[model samples]
Target: METSLLAFLLISLAKVIVVVVILLMAVAYTVLLERKLVGRIQNRWGPSRVGPFGLLQPLMDGAKLFLKEDLIPEAVYRPLYILAPIIALGCALMSIAVVPFGADIRWKGVDLFEIADVNIGLLIILGITSVGVYGIALSGWSSNNKYSLLGALRASAQVISYELALGLSLVGVVLRSGSLRLRDIVDVQSTHGLLSWNFFGGFQFVAFLIYLMAAYAETNRAPFDLPEAESELTAGYHTEYSSMKFAMFFMAEYGNMITVGCVATLLFFGGWTSPFGNLFPEPHNAILLSFLSLFWFVAKVFCFLFLYIWVRGTLPRFRYDQLMGFGWKFLIPVAVANIVVTSFFIGLRLPLH
Candidate 1:
C-alpha cells in the first residue's frame, strides 16, 4: 500500500510537469499562430525574420518579456494584484489534469498515457474553470484603476452570462451520454460515428453551436474580447500588470483556449477517437492507437484555435450592449430551447440512430 501511494505521487508529479511544459509551448505557438493568421487576413507579412518563417517569434517575445522590468503602479493592492494572475494561470493549468491525451499504453506492465482517470472529470474541469473568473475580477479591483475596474466588471458580467448558456448547451451532451465522466463521454462518441455524434443530431447540433459561441465569449476571445479591448480599455484588467505577472494572465488566456478546445473536441469531435473507426477496428496496438488518438485530438484542437485567430482577424469587436443582448436574448433562449427539444426527442425514442 505504501509503495502504491508513492507510485501515484510520483506519477501525479510527472503529469503536472508534462502538462505545464505542454501548456507553455502551446501558449508560445498560439501567439505565433495568431500573428501569422492575422497577417494573412490583412494581406501583409507577419513575423518572417525570427527563425524560419517566424517559428521562433514566440521565443523572442518570451525572452523580451522576461528581460523587461517589472512594474507595479502606485496605490494598488499589492497582495491581491500579485495573486490574481497566479490564480488564473494555476486554475487554467489544473483543468488539463483530467484531459486524456491518448488511449492507455502499457509499458513495464503499467498504463502510461493519461494522468488521473477521475470519475468526476467533467465536474472537476467545470469547477476549476468557473473559479477562473475570480482572477479577472480580483485583478481589476486590485489595480485600483478605473479602466481596469471597468474591464473587470465587463469580464465578470461576460463570464457569468455566457457560463449559463455554456452549461445549458452541455446539458444535452451530458444527458445523452448519461454520465459526467470525461472518459465515458469519449466512449459514447467513439461508439457512435460522426453522424451519430451528439453535435450531429438536430437539437444537439444546435446546442453544440450555442456551446461554441458561448465558449468563445467565455474565454474572452476576439469579437467577444471586450474585456481586453485595447481600443477602449488599454489592455483591460491587466493594464497595470507587468513582467512575469502580466505573462501569467497571458498564459492563462491561451491555456484556457486550449482547455476549451479540448473540451469541445472531447464532447463533440469524438475525443481521442479516430475519424474513420469503421475502417479500423482494432484498439490493441497500444502505441499506434495512442499516436492516432493524440493526432486526431491535436488536429481538432488546432482547427478550433485557427478558427479563433481567423475570427479575431476577420470580425470587429462587439459593442458592450450588443454582447450582453446576444448572450441573454439569443444564446440563452436558443440553448434552453435546444435542451427542451433534445429532451422531448430523447423521450420519444425516435429513429435518431
Candidate 2:
C-alpha cells in the first residue's frame, strides 16, 4: 500500500509539472497564432522581425514583458491588486487539471492523461472557471482606476449571463451520454463517424451553436469583448498592471481560449476519434495508439482555435446591451428548448449514442 501511494504521489506531481509547462508553451504560441492569423485577415505582415515566420515571437514577448519595469500605483489597494492577476492565472490553469488529453498513456502502470479522475470533472472545471470572474473583479476594483473598474464590471456581468447558456448547452450531451464524466462523453462518440457524432449525428446542432456563442462571450473574445474594448476601457481591468503582472492577464486569456477549444472538441466533436474509424485501426501497441489519438485530438482542437481567431478578425464588437440581451433573450431560451428536444428524443428511446 505504501509503495502504491508513493507511486501515485510521484505520478501526480509529474502530471502537474507536465501540464503547466505544456499549457504555458501552448498559451504563448496561441498569442502568436492570433497575431499571424489576424495579420493575414488584414493584409499585413505580422511579427516578421521576431523570428522565422515569427515563430519565436512569443519568447521575445515574454522576455520583453519580464524586463520592463514593474509599476504600482500608490492609491491602489496593494494586496488585492497584487493578488488579482495571480488568482486569474491560477484559476485558468486550475481548470485544466481535470481535462483529459487526446489519448491516455501509461508509464509504469500509471495513466498520464489527466491529473484527476473525479466523477464530476465537468462540474469541477466549470466551478473553477467561475471563480476566475472574482479575479477580474478584484483586479479592476483594486486598481483604483475608473476604466479598470468599468471593464471588470462589464466582463463579469457578461460572463455570468453567458454561463447560464453555457451550462444549459451541455445538458443535451449529458442527457444523451447519461454521464458527467468528460471522458465518457467523448467515448460515446467514438464508435460513430463524423455524421454520427454529437454535434452532427445526435441532432444537437442547436445546442452546439449556443455553446459556441456562449464560449466566445465567456472568453471575452470579439463581438463579446466589450469589457476590454480599447477605445473605451483603455485595455480594461489590466490597465493599471505593468510588466509581468500585465502579461499574466493575457496569459490567462489565451489559456482560457485553449481550454474552451479543448472542451468544445471533447463535448461536441468526436474528440480524438478519427472520422474514418475503420480505415485507421487502433495500433496493436498501446503507446502507438496514444500518439495516433493524440494527433486526431490536436487536429480537432486546431480547427476550433482557428475558428476563434477567424471570428475575432471578422466580427464587429457587439454593443453592451446587445451582448446582454442576446445572451438572456436568445441563447438562454434556445438552450432550454434544445434541452427539451433532447429529452423528448431520449424519452422516445432514440439510440443517440
Candidate 3:
C-alpha cells in the first residue's frame, strides 16, 4: 500500500512539474507568435532583431522584465497587492491540471499524459475559471490607484457577465455526451469520422460558436478585451504591477488563453482522437498510438491558439457597454436556448452524431 501511494505521489509531482514547464514555454512562444502574426497582418516586421526571425524575442522580453525595477507604490494594500498576481497565476495554472490532454494510456498499470481524471471534471474546470476572476478583481482593488481599480472592475465585470453564457453554452455539450467528464465526451466522438466532432454535424455547432465567443470574453481576448482598454484604464488591473509581478499577470492572461483553447479542443474537437482513426485504431500498439494521440491533441490545440491570434489581429475591441450588452443580452439568451433545444432533441433520442 505504501509503495503504491509513494508511486502515485511521485507521479503526480512529475506531472505537475512537466505541465508547468510546458505551459510557461507555450505562453512565451504564444507571445512571440502573436507579435509575428499581427505584424504580418499590418505589413510590418515584428521583433526581427532579437534573434533568428525573433524566435528569441520572448526570452529577451523575460530577461528585460526581470532586470527592471520591482515597484510597490505607497498607499496600496500591500499584502493583497502582492498576493493578487500569485492568485491569478496559480488559478490559471491549476485549471490546466483537470484538462485531459489525450486518451488515458496506461502501461503496466500507470497512466500517462493526464494528471487527474475526476468524475466531475467539467465542474472543476468551471469552478477554477470562476475563481480566477477574484485574482484580477483583487489586484485592481488593492492597487490603490483609481485607474487600476477602474480597469480591474471593468475587466472583472466583463468576465462575470460572460461567464453565465460560457457555462450555459457547455451545457448543450454535456447533455449531448451525457457526461461531465471530459474524457467521456471525447469518447463519444472516438472512432468516428470528422463530422463526429461536435463542431461539425453534432448539432452542437451553435454551442461551439457561443462557447467560442464567451471564451474570448472570459480570457479577455480581443473584441471582448475591454478590461485592459488602453484608451480607458491604461493597463487595467495590472497597471500598477511592475517587473516580475507584472509578468505574473501577463503569464496569467496567456495561461488562461491556453486553458480556454485546451477546453475548446477537448470539448468540441474530439480531444486526442485522430482524424484518421480508421487507419490508426486505439487497440494498436499502445505506445505508438499514444504518441499519435499526443500529436493530434497538440495539433488541434495549436490550431485553436492560431485562431486566437488570428482573431486578435483581425477584430477591433468592443466598447465596454457593447461588451456587456452582447454577453448578457444576446449571448446568454442564445446559450440558454441552445441548451433547451439540445436537451429536448437529445431527450427524444434523436440520432445525433
> In candidate 3, where is summed lDDT lowest over 10 consecutive residues?
275-284
Candidate 1, residues 1-353: lDDT per residue as tens digits? 13466676777687678878987899899988988989988999999998989999999999988998999888999999989998999998889888887765655444465667888888898889889999999999999998899999999999999999998999888888888988888888776467556667323778778888998998899889998999899999999998888988999999999999988888887887777767668567767788888898899899889988888898899999999999999999998897887788777885755
Question: TM-score of each candidate?
Answer: 0.95, 0.96, 0.96
Question: What would the per-residue lDDT of candidate 2 be over residues 9-127, giving only the tens digit for each residue?
Answer: 99999999998999999999888989999999999977878778989999999999999999999999999999999999999899998888866666766667878877898888789
Evaluate model 1: give its lDDT. Answer: 0.86
The lDDT per prediction is 0.86, 0.89, 0.87
Q: 1 or 2, which is superior by lDDT?
A: 2
Which candidate has the top score in TM-score? 2
**In model 2, where do residues sit more than 4 Å from their true spots?**
1-3, 350-353
What TM-score should be assigned to candidate 1?
Answer: 0.95
Please count the clashing residue pairs in each candidate, in the order shown: 0, 0, 0
Task: Give the TM-score (vs. native) of candidate 3.
Answer: 0.96
